[model samples]
Target: MSGWTAHLPVLPVVLPLIAGAAIVLIDDGKRPLRALLAVLATLAQLGVALWLAGIAGGLLHSPWGSEIGVYAAGNWAAPFGIVLVVDRLSALLLVLTAALGLMTLLYSLARWDRAGVNFLPLFQFLLMGLNGAFLTGDLFNLFVFFEVLLAASYGLLLHGSGAARVRAGLHYIAVNLVASLLFLLGAALIYGVTGTLNLADIARKLPALTGADRSLFDIGAVLLGIVFLVKAAAWPLNFWLTPAYSSAAAPVAGVFALMTKVGVYALLRMGTLFEPGGRPPLFGGDWLFYGGLATIATGAAGMLAAQQLGRLAGHAVIVSSGTLLAAIGLLGNQYTPSMLLYLCSSVLATGAFFMLIEMVERNRSYGADLLAVSFEAFGLADPDDPTGPDDVVGIAIPAAMAFLGLSFVMCALLITGLPPLSGFVAKFGLIAAALEGAAGLTPVGSWVLIAALLLSGLAGLIALTRNGIRVFWSNARSTPRLQVAEAGPVAALLLLCVALAALAGPAMDYLQGTAATLHAPERYINAVLQAEGVGR
Candidate 1:
């Protein structure tokens, strides 16, 4: 590859880092300028991500004679210096993060950015952390990037001043602090035992260790798994997710949908890296299997019991996380391609739903006012006339409510895995693969997953149906005036989901290739360990 092409792996992380630093130096009075800068930076990041994905897909093949792009910082080689590796998986996630960042920032430009100091900077920093985490090839830097994003999230969670936001933010902060400590302890133990923090190096070294040393590594690995589980919001460890996410500002909550996925991403990377052929046989697979089932159950129960739309969305995030975790735990390569599709569908649907919640609530209040006025006017109409003012009430729904309702229904269908959408395609593919025992999944485990998938969809259907009725069918007085800034992003997100459905054939083909590559990690290991320098 050309020198410049080889450097694509690091740009996703570096661009946002520079922009965040620049935003921090700007005065708060120039809020408009800050927003503009954030938009430009995120757009550029998106471009880079798309380009890297092209490289991974062989659509932008280089002279380097390799599929993966590996970058070593400061001309340092692997096992001795920092490395950033971009394959199909990391490239895919980078694209997702950048797309979400751009859309969320656009929505925030309406008014959410003014809710707190340094909002623009924090947003950029969060993107930087997320990109860094996805691209980093070592456990130590993963912990560092994890902290970077979590710190920014703490500020964003409490962006608006309110008792609920503050209370939830505090709890969120406490839980993450403990998780970070566990991450550190676990990292230190692994580094001490293996004498390396690089993932490829660790995998290379695993089979050589004996007796007590191997046991020590296992303990550290389990501890690290717990840290990831907590972040993934698996069952008992997930109590804080719904409250914190539900109470945060809409834009913040929209972007936060990807945060839990970060945990899932980490687990996937590490779990596959340590599979039987490379290191110890996959540790914690059973826990992930059972924990995921419990997480699905918890999310379904929470969704059914939730009184507010935001909390319901929060539960939906938990359900998505559990679904992926369980699929991974089953150790079925056949399931990964389908799971990837479901992951994309869930993230987009949940993010759009979070944004839609505020608009729906606003319209409901406005509709209430309009209804009162209509009732007063009807009371003065002639009682004997069959087609008097009452006739107008039947068809008087506002355009904004119509838009919001349509968007809400689409979101509901996407989340619940119903027909004619990407959601159904994904869930069906997964179920088919599981039932066929394509990857050695036991009958009991397959049945459990089937039950979770079907029951969770039912729970979501009931919850969203009730909320839709209350928000639209109940009572409203006036039509809510929706702005392009508010409604446009929601439309764009839903349209993307539609597009995914339309392009299901190509998307599945790509994901299937990605799954195949992931299951065979030797190429990844070679790419990292054999790199000479940036342009070699």
Candidate 2:
């Protein structure tokens, strides 16, 4: 690679930042122009992401080799200057983020973009933040990117301006604000002890710390872990997730699915980077194990009890987070590849589910009235649906409802890890890996995880079945006319999941390579620290 291509590592971040700033200057009245610009920028981002992934996978190569790409800001050296590092893991996630952004942006063009000012600009900024967070090689920049995305999310959450949205947005903002404070405190403590903000430098320094310094560093690390868990929506700290996500507009909620994985990415990075090598195990292994199980239970219960499709989708996010966290706790290299595959499938399905919720709920009054009449027959009148017109016979469901129903069923299978889909492939791989002693899980722990996986899948199945019945089978007043913009994205997302299932072998190979790189952090650290004067 030569010239601009050499800077691919940073381009993912910079391109979006520049585009976002440019978009902010565009006249709000020029919606068509602004939308066009946003789509073009996101398309460019997707191209960059695919290019970087290709390089990381050795399908393409540069002077820096196939494993990693490093770009030092302003040609500065490591441990002193800002740097962006891209490896297989980061590249995969960047692609996921860009892909989702493009799809959601396209869907927003149907209507949601008009719901608020600066939607395109805010979206561009959100992408910039996500890419930066994934690529940044230091703690400080990570925090900066976190704030960037959070700020964008705040606006997106309140984009349509409803009482429920505002209430949920406030709660979301408050929780994240506290997480940000903890992030700062933890970063400061780590910097004080390690004398560097760079992730590679901190890893290099950690093995040498002694006495009270190590203890303090450990405390800081724990604080950082807590913050990440909150973002990951772990049990006891995840109450705000369902309400906030469910209240947001469809496009915004769809893209927000990636936000929780950012937390998982941080934990994976830190855990692999800072492992003590030959020392005793650190603090979070058991915490992740038990906490993940608890989260799974909570999410399962929430999904089973959820009356609204939106809330059910929110709980589905929790279930995905819990699964990944639990897998991390198992500490098996064999499981990591399968876990990565599962992560990809889950994120895709969940995002599609959120988008589908809007389409499905548009005609909910029909089923709701049916529900009300049934209750009245049982001598209990529903105040919310008081004495409406009697149900009309021969009401036909719309083609849109058929589309929504099919998509919802697919989402259900994907989320529940049922057979013949990518979800089952992922779950089976995980279970097989665990039972084979790939992660060295204790007998009890293995059984516990296996049971959790099965039970969670069962709960998801039950909840989605009920939701599908109510939404698609019950009589509705009228069928919603599906817009091409809305239906196209949802179809594309579900098709991608199908393709994932069909191409499981190659996808697993790529993910396995990513998992290997993550477990061996030296390759990453060397790639960043060795950049020196390259790409300047």
Candidate 3:
């Protein structure tokens, strides 16, 4: 933790930004150099994240005196100027973002073209925004980081600009732009109320509100929540997700796995800021459980309705998003660490599957009709020469489809809070918190969550089975050779999924510790304040 302060939180963002810009300046023909920069930038971020997490954990362990690692640019103090703060919560999220960033980069390495116009630069910029969002102590700064992410995503989403890609990317951008506008509006209103945009300051100031001002403040908070809910793809606001995500390039979709979670992080972070010290922050309880219930239902229905793998994966993402949001909304500011724990793993798993969808697509040579025909006709297209175009039907991909099917089934269970996955751990924490909140009044909300969780699991199983039976069992043939370039990165991503499943115990403990520190922002506030000469 010694040199940790010197590097400060801003270095994480800066490192990536600088790297991305440098990548853009590199000659496109130099693919190897570009890849090197991309990988190094990602690795640098990972190292920073690990170091920051360790420092944060150490600080939290010794209550006698703990440092949150606050560094003010140009020695400027908080409330009046820009500041960066790294507490246990932000530190943990930084690690998640970093790990995911690193994984996505590695996935793209063997898979994506390094010499592309926007790939490396945009990716690095997106990380810059993500790290900034996690570390910034100011509301306006958060907005800036959000835009940084949005801008980079705009390029990444439309990378190839194929008809499907362009259409999906446009929708994604339009929907999020509106959301961004609303976010700005909400921030403006909050500034009007508190006269300061620092989150900790807002927290301290919001507690003093009363009468119409309190109502106004609550309304602003709700508006801000709406923006994040949209980002997180919560029920009514999630319409944009299906098209946008379904049509994107595989790696692009994989990267977006981080975007929606940004919404979750913002919601959790801002919710904690708005909530005062004490019992679940007033209306937090209802928001968490009810929102979660609605999200679960919608996601389940979406999956059942989806037909194609891409669309199916898109819907699954929605379902996972809803699960995380509902959990956080239910747990309030206090137990969000548990929610985040599940969220991080779920994001990774969802991302890996999304990437896998592309790989599966690459291996196929026939259209849906051809695939169906293969089931009926004995002359199925040759799996080895998918390009044969023999027009034969009635072939099958029993093995390949079966593997893909299992992955889908596991993903569904993972998203639905089933055991042996990180999803279960996250849900467990939230459910326990919800029951405690209910304190036993028949706990209608808790019952609703239980039912929703069960139903989602069942729905996911049926959906996966249905898809699997069609793709792997009944027909298929006409296969293509696996592109090692693409296959390698996807395999790497899958390994992450296995690790998440296998290492749930240590991950949960880390999450619990991070959650505890988040609930008590004294360390966070103190870290920033102390950087400005306030007492330890």
Clashes of each: 11, 2, 11
For model 2, how does the per-residue alpha-carbon lDDT over 201-319 read when each residue is reduced to its tens digit?
88888889989988888888888888899989999899999999999889999999999999988888888888643222322478887888999999999999999999999999999
> Mind giving the per-residue lDDT tens digits that candidate 3 earns over 55-88?
7777333221454767666666777888887777
List TM-scores for all candidates, in order.
0.92, 0.92, 0.86
Candidate 2: global Cα-lDDT? 0.85
Question: Which candidate, 1 or 3, would have the higher lDDT against the true structure?
Answer: 1
Cα lDDT, all candidates: 0.84, 0.85, 0.71
Off by over 4 Å in 3: 1-5, 59-67, 114-116, 277-283, 332-337, 366-413, 429-442, 483-485, 533-536
Clashes of 1: 11
Better of 1 and 3 by TM-score: 1
TM-score of structure candidate 1: 0.92
Residue-wise lDDT of candidate 1 within 1-536, one digit each (tens)?
46577788888888888899999998887877888899999999999999988888878875356778788988698889999988889989999899888888888786567655688889998998999999999899999999999999998888755677888989999999999999999899999899999998887788787789888898788788888888889988999999999988888999999999999998888877777433333233677778888899999999999999989999999999999888888777889999999998999999999999976875444222123333343242322246655522223234887898899999999999998888999999989998897665678888888999999999999999998888888755355556677788888889989999999998988889889878887778888999878655
TM-score of candidate 3 on Cα atoms, chains taken together: 0.86
Error of 1 at 329 (Å): 0.6
